[model samples]
Target: MQDTLSNKALLKATVIAVFIAGLALVSFILPAEYNIDPTGIGAKLGLTALANPKAAVVSGAETKATIDVPKSVQAADIIEVIIPAGRGLEFKFAMEKFKKMEYQWQTDGAAIFFDLHGEPEGDTTGYYESYAIATLADMQGSFTTPFAGVHGWYWKNKSAQAVVITLTVSGEYSVIGLKK
Candidate 1:
């Protein structure tokens, strides 16, 4: 009788341990390592950024084809753009493979949804990649092009008021233009 009781307790303990481990893996490891957040907790905690270092590389390659920019842009472009409420804009520059660009942009204390991405030229398939997706008042970073194409930002103002964006870029790009 005692042996039977011991076997039941051991089986129960083993099952409980496995269940707890599975929960941890699904909730934490899956999001932080693979960006697979079925539970949505990873996105809320910002753990999604930790997955897939290649996301930036894929974005640069994909963004190279999406927008059209001038083939002869200056080495430095400073532009201030105002986006009215509920408006959006796309600004991009023509870049070559391995070219590097430093950029910074800021809003007037109002947050906006921004996509930093790239689309390759001559890709009519309408495919692009995203390096970053942010909802913030400002962003600053530098990118080394993974492939030749157009690279830039698409921003939308969902706020109740107009937002001013001041953008500064210096790099190996040929031209920068706003997509109309």
Candidate 2:
């Protein structure tokens, strides 16, 4: 009879331990490491940002600007910009409907968080669409505008040191300008 009671107690303890471990995995480990927050606790605790590769750590005001290009002009522009540590900058070009552009950008051996996005022309609601969010040292791609709008990249230098970015563009964009 004593043996039966001891066995029951052992089984109960084992089940409880397993349940607790599962709970920990679901609530903390998965969310903190992989951004899988089924319970939403990770976002409340700000752990999801850590898991996001494109989340920028900005420490100051960001600047933005637009450059106008003649519609009939054809050229290639290479722009270089420097971002201080913990600061961010935005560079964009005005594009017309169905316009296409090829672009390549690289950082000075430092990984930076970036958002590739577009805003429709005369959008007063401050609405924008995000095409990609990435943490990378370099990127190369071609974009075809779905509508008349401004398409560009927002890059943030999250490291402890300043970083220089070089952007090369070819194709149908009218104007290319930087914001701060």
TM-score of every prediction relative to native: 0.58, 0.60
Cα lDDT tens digits for candidate 1, 50-72: 67321111121122322234433
Q: What lDDT score goes with residue 18 in model 2?
A: 99
lDDT of 1 at 173: 76
Tens-place lDDT per residue, model 2, 1-180, is 353558889999999999999998888888878999999988777666456423122223334322344433344556666778988888778888888888888988999999999999999998999988999999999888888988898898989998888777777775546644
Model 2 clash count equals 2
Mark the regions of model 1 whose C-alpha exceeds 4 Å error after superposition: 1-75
Candidate 1 TM-score over all chains jointly: 0.58
